[model samples]
Target: MDRIRIGLVGIGKIARDQHLPALNQGGDFDLAATASRNGRVDGVEAHETVDALIAARPDIAAISLCTPPAGRFEQAMAAIAAGRHVMLEKPPAATVSEAEALAEAARAKGVTLFATWHSREAAEVDAARGWLADKAIRAVRIMWREDIRQWHPGQDWILAPGGFGVFDPGINALSIATRILPDPLVVLSAELAIPENRACPIAATIAMRCGTAPVAVDFDFLQTGDQTWDIEVDTDAGTLYLRNGGSRLELPGAEPMQGPNAEYPRLYARFAELIRNGESDVDLRPLRLVADAFLTGQPTPAPAFEF
Candidate 1:
């Protein structure tokens, strides 16, 4: 099959670090253009806005959006209207309604819409899911903590109302958990630590349930030293550990299974497959869990933070 000419929106760190590399890895996509305010790719056609890119490149049949979730709904809508398949970054939109609207619009336009959870593509994620499919889950714990200065740097949008703050990364854990756990998660309680000067939470402790199993999540954006992105699940058989953002998995009485970071590459592969099959993959379970946390969470004031 011919390569799908694709344009990338948002040339930020994620685009440069992940999307660009995956697109250049000689897969089913051709990097045709990019749209960003200040960032640009080395030889690709660049535009300052998605509208301009859409108008200028009619040959681009797909748009992969890595932009912040705040205003992504309009961009996705425009692309879907133009008959281009759209791939959205995790936490697809600022609100569940926006994400749902995009999905409905894409379906009406008969275009593929992929709301990608890149963490679900981590090396051992699928294996972990397969292994847990039949196990009786007893309990689960998710610890996703990292320094915002080290990862997001001075990106103040994270503290903005729609940026999702800690949930931006916390949702990755939820994505993996939702994928591997057999039952659906229901957020029972959440304690959110909001910076005195910010609109979003800097840390959150969420208590949830998956069937009879209790799930606990600890999310923080101010960790300094060694970062932690780990999930531990206790089952009737034994314990399962997915560490390093799901790239490494450790099972009871067995050696760890680890693999290189291929999340973005695998995500692109799935997008290509969906486009070819005339289907859309817009799993909103993880996002819904985040939304539930926000809805039921009790806010507490924390010290003001700065990067």
Candidate 2:
């Protein structure tokens, strides 16, 4: 199989830390080019804009767009128009409608458009999903807290209007919940703790109606010690837990089982498979829930956060 020539857009921290390393090591992709205003990858052709990348690297078969969700729709449409497959980062677009439109356009253009949920590809997540396939979940609890300064660093866009803030990481939990649950989830209510100085919420307590049961998600960006990303479910059979970002799973009566930390590698492989099979993978349930929270959630003021 010919390796897919990929152009990476938005070469920020994630591109350097996760995407670049995964692409370089994966056998299915070649880092043919990069498009970023200030960031560049060594040994790869760099362009300041996607237009230049499309014109200069005609051999590029696919583009992995890691840009922020705000302007993703236009760039994704551009890629599809150029006859290239697109793999979007999480929260495919700022709005679910935009993601749906992109999917429709991709189908019209007959190109593969992959919306990635990296956390969904974890081995343990797959196992948990299989376990809960037949069981009934009574409730779910999610605690996803991390130090934004440590995770996002100097990225100012995270606090922008389109930026999700705590929901940025919180969406990962929602993605997993939506996938593992047997029934659909709807946002029931939410409390957003906005910093006086920032545009987005710094902490949040979200409630959801997962099927008949209530699911609660607690998210905080100011957590300092032992950054946690954990989810626990109370089911008819027993309790199921995914701690340490879905890398570990615990069941009712069994020993704790650990899974591989290969989310990015598996994600890239899935992208390749979609391109090879001539299909698009676009799931917006997670993003939709976030959008709903914004529409229906009540604002709760918190102390001003200083970066």
Candidate 3:
């Protein structure tokens, strides 16, 4: 099959770090063009807007959007309307309604739409899922904390109302959790700690319930040491731990499981498959959980944060 000609919409940190590397490794796609206000990938035709890129690069078959959620809906719709497949970064859109609209539009246009969840592709996630398939889950806990300054320096969109704040990384944990858990879950209670000077929360404590199993998720941006991205589950058989964001899995009387670091590469491969198969992969479960937390969760004022 001929390689797909691809364009990148947002060339921010994630696009540069994860998406570009993944696309290069996939080898099924050619980086035909890119559109960004301030960032650009080497050797690719650059445009300041998606519209211009689409208008100029008629050979492009798909576009990957890596922008913030605030303005993603329009860009995605435009791309789909122009007869191109779209791969959206996590938190598909600012609101569920917008994401639904994008899905519907993609259906009408007969193009593939992928809501990419890189964490779900982590090395140990599939192994952990296989182990937990038969175990009776009693409870689940997720502790994800990191310093914003170190991870997201100078990224103002994260602090904006639609930016999702700590839920940015928090959504990653949710993605892995929803993928591994055996039962459907919903948010029961939540407390968001918003920094006094920002519109979004810097920390959040969420309580979720799935059938009889209770789950607790803690996301914070104030950690100083040993950043944690770990999920633990207590089952009737034994305790299961997925540390390092599903990169490492541990169980009683079992050696740790590890795999190749090719999340982006794998994602692009899946995208190619979906495009060839004429199907769409749009899982809103993870983003739905985050929106529910924002809508139904309680709010707590936190100390001012400066980065």
Candidate 4:
């Protein structure tokens, strides 16, 4: 009961890059094992699937899902079915319906579940929320531009039918924006620039509203030059800046605040807390916003993209 033995279900890039280090840092958990079809962490017991991992290590108290959203539903349900706690990465699943179903299933099974928005745990993001609490927000602008090839070179699933291309990164911005803003922003109008050869959009422009305030978001997958990940909100007081994917915050009159690059570490800590407390944290507002955008969005055809 002192340390929960957890199994990592996906050993892809994010697992090796972030989760492995965070799990090893001691936060009420012991990295019990790993399951993956393609990759794995060294020195950990590896299995080909969560089912296999469960069969081998029946003592794993929890299962962390680091796989892409497209396959998250089945894997997570399998873990919950086995009466194990579940932790999911951002966006939860490919569709809002699936995410909701998984949450309901976890609740019915009496197991704790977590759908984490890692960016919300950023220290600078916390600062921004504190500052915005006293300010009257008006308008917001978000530019989340990055090179897909550089970030997801061979992840062909990103362009598949249920894949969320630009939204994969843009949802991180939405997570922070929704966390720090004064009110909830709902999607109004959206334009998705879909490639002729792909199923998902490579770029998107969205207009949203929070009461009378207008919010604009631009998500692009072709910014190979200077990658920009910034959010600016113009309030009655002054403009507030949460830049570098919420690692830096700038208020009207305060110094730029920075935090250690430990977004994943903080995510793991929160997951452990929820599991220990016998509670579930499954907030789907960000994913619901994405779903609304898709439902109300108009498609704008772009040049054919092979990759």
**lDDT of each residue in 116-187, candidate 4, tens digit only:** 998888779988888889788889999999999888887888878888988998999999888988888999
What value does the lDDT take at residue 190 in candidate 1? 100
Q: Write the per-residue lDDT of candidate 3 for residues 186-238, one digit (tens) a residue.
A: 99889999988999999999999866999999999888778999999999989
Clashing pairs in 3: none
TM-score of each model, in listed order: 0.99, 0.98, 0.98, 0.97
Model 4 spans > 4 angstroms off: none
Q: How well does candidate 2 score on lDDT at residue 63?
A: 95
Clashing pairs in 4: none
Off by over 4 Å in 2: none
Taken over the whole model, the C-alpha lDDT of each candidate is 0.95, 0.90, 0.91, 0.90
lDDT digits (tens) for residues 172-281 of candidate 2 = 98888888889898888999998887888999998888789888889999999899989999999999999888889999999999987888889999999999999999
Mind giving the per-residue lDDT tens digits that candidate 1 earns over 135-226?
A: 99999999999999998989999899999999999999999999999999999999999999999999999999999999999999999999
N/CA/C clash count, model 1: 0
Evaluate model 4: give its lDDT.
Answer: 0.90
Q: Give me the displacement of residue 150 in model 1, in angstroms.
A: 0.9
* Cand. 3 TM to true fold: 0.98
Q: How many angstroms is residue 54 displaced in model 3 relative to the true structure, after the best TM-score fit?
A: 0.3
